[model samples]
Target: MSGQTMYEKIWRSHEIVDLGDGFSLLHVDRHMLHDGSGPVLARLKERGRSVSQPDLCFATLDHVVSTAPGRPVTSDNRRRTIASLRDGVAEAGIRFFDIGRTGQGIVHVIGPELGISLPGTVVVCADSHTCTHGGMGAMGFGIGSTEAEHVLATQTIVQAKLRTMRVTFVGNAGDGVTAKDLILAAVGQLGSAGGNGYAVEYAGRAIQTLEVEARLTLCNLSIELGAKVGMVAPDEKTFDYLAGRQFSPKNELWNRALASWRDLPSDHDAIFDAEIEVDISHLKPKITWGTSPAHVMDIDGIVPDPSSTGHRNAVQYMDVVPGRPLVGLKVDWVFIGSCTNSRISDLRIAANIVGGRKVADHVSAWIVPGSENVKRQAESEGLDRIFKESGFEWREPGCSLCLAANGEAVPPGARAVSTSNRNFVGRQGPGARTHLASPAVAAASAIRGVISDFRTMKD
Candidate 1:
């Protein structure tokens, strides 16, 4: 057999033959939908086409639902989406995980955490960060609303083949460094458009050592680097993380699944279209310096002088002066929770930083869980109490500040440190500046009212 990259292997396996125009019809093994996108699927049925593969589609109510524990669902948009999801699931026979349901969370988080995302599967979602599933070695990407409708009707979509990019990170990650930091560093080095027209495969010792959540964090930012998808080869860590999840196989089936996952790694001599290398030992906790994920620097580094760099438009829009210190920069808000870092472990780490701490007098902080399940788990461990007592608002689970979809948004000119992906200008809101970081860093920034290091705090 010929050697191939993991992307090549998976893409070839799912190929349904070419359809011309640089696109090929591809079979979708798993299709996830959410409140924001569920309405479109419902409309498709209104036109008389049933979901071709109901078993292949899953629906969840998240994006606009009230994340407040024990609170009744509110918001007209949310209500409509939830109702449509209910109707769509019933009419289409798709699996649904509604709010308060056992499997409910951010659709992206629910997939891999529940083991519905498996090696070699082709997963598609209506959300961009769907690449997060690539952490389990799956081939996944986001789809637009119209495309979502197509997948709902046929369980297939057309995709252009992509070049493969290999990013190898050697050496141990220094203390306080995380997969988030590594990806941030890589994006910083490569620029936001670096991985355009390619899928990225993360390799080397540092990547191998990352836990499944950390690996997901790495792949989650792949889009920021312009990759269509990003993935890490599944290994023992992948199997261990999936072992007892709700959708994971059990008994002899579990063993069979493990055996298959173990073989999903690329061969020793696999070739990639391009390659990049990073050393994690030199990486630091990163903070976005401009409006993009590529505009980043170490937590302790000075804000960049846009004059020194080439992205003049971004610097002018960000209004960041050249060579100013990023440390002690005043921020209006701090947000934690998003599909990116809203898991239980992410909450635990943020809580450790916020416990016995108080938010700066002038700063407002919002802690939104990624899902109802994450909220329940965090509350059970008293993580919510720590956040509440720290002057942070512990709200219901939803996209919240991540997308400003539920009337939760930072005002214009407000600067914030966020745990969510993307920091593009007006991404949070018009003129609302966002700096992306890990949850620990976001929590610490809230306490200090500036970008601060979590390593200085005691657990």
Candidate 2:
């Protein structure tokens, strides 16, 4: 038998048939929808069609909804979109997690945290970070709005089979190095499009050591490297994280699921189309110097000289001088919450960093949970109190700050250290500057009023 990466193994197992021209028809097991995409399905209903597999599709409101406490959704456009979602879900008999409902959060975050994303499942959503579910050893990706309509009509999607790339991270990370930093370093080394036309399998001791939430953060950015999907092999960590979640199987069924998941890893000598290795021991807390995710350096390192590279446009967009250190750069805001780092663990880490500390008077900070459950979990542990006492606004759960929707945005020319997935210029707001980092780093920067390191601060 030929060797295969974990991605290839899972893909082959789910392949319905080859459709020629490099494309194949694959079966989809889980479908997720957000309020923004829900209206499309409602439009399809006007044409006299219903969801093909209601049981497999789920909907939740995240985008275009204010996460501020006691803020009723007041925008007419937003209300119409949400109303369409409610009507569509009811008409199709699909599950819907309405605003204020239990288990509601960002589409990517709520899926995994609820255990609806399982090993070997084929998941898809209208949002790009659908790849986040791949951390559970599943095959998942995002689709366009029209394609989402097709999936709602039939529980399958047409797609071209992708090449497989294997990324192995060796050695343990040093103090203050996080999965975010490791991925940033990988992006720097490989360039932004290195994984183009491939599904990436992340393996090695360092990756296995990460908690499930951290692994999700790594997989969440796979698309940034131009990969269709990114995944890690299922193991104890994956199972442990799902053991007690609401949608997970219980008792005997749990044992069966675990046994099935145990066999999901790729066999020894599985061949990959391409391979790259990274040394995690050399990783450090990272910060983005340019407008793209690839333009990154260690927190202690200086911004790259634009004259040294052909990508002058990026340097110009970021408005940074070459050889200037990112540390001590004045920032106007700090944002902590996104599908990438809104898990309860992420909140705890940020809270610990700013527990008794106050944000610098000049910097505004926002803390949005990925989901309502995560919000409640943080509040139960008093993590919310820590953030509030430190002058950080702890808001409701949603994709707040990660995207500029719902009126939550950083003003133009404002520099922000965010825990969101991308650092693309204007991604958070028009002409806004975004520097991506981990939750701890965002918290530390909030306290110091600049790009600061969390390791220097003790709880």
In terms of lDDT, the best-performing candidate is 2
List the global CA lDDT of all models: 0.84, 0.87
Backbone clash count, each prediction separately: 5, 4
Candidate 2: tens digits of C-alpha lDDT, residues 254-372: 99989878878877888888889988777889988888888888888888777555447777766777788888888899999999989998898898789889999999999999998
Lowest summed lDDT window (length 10), candidate 2 = 307-316
What lDDT is reached at residue 2 by model 1? 60
lDDT agreement of model 2 with the native: 0.87
What TM-score does each of the candidates earn? 0.94, 0.97
Pairs in steric clash, model 1: 67-396, 67-397, 68-396, 291-423, 305-322
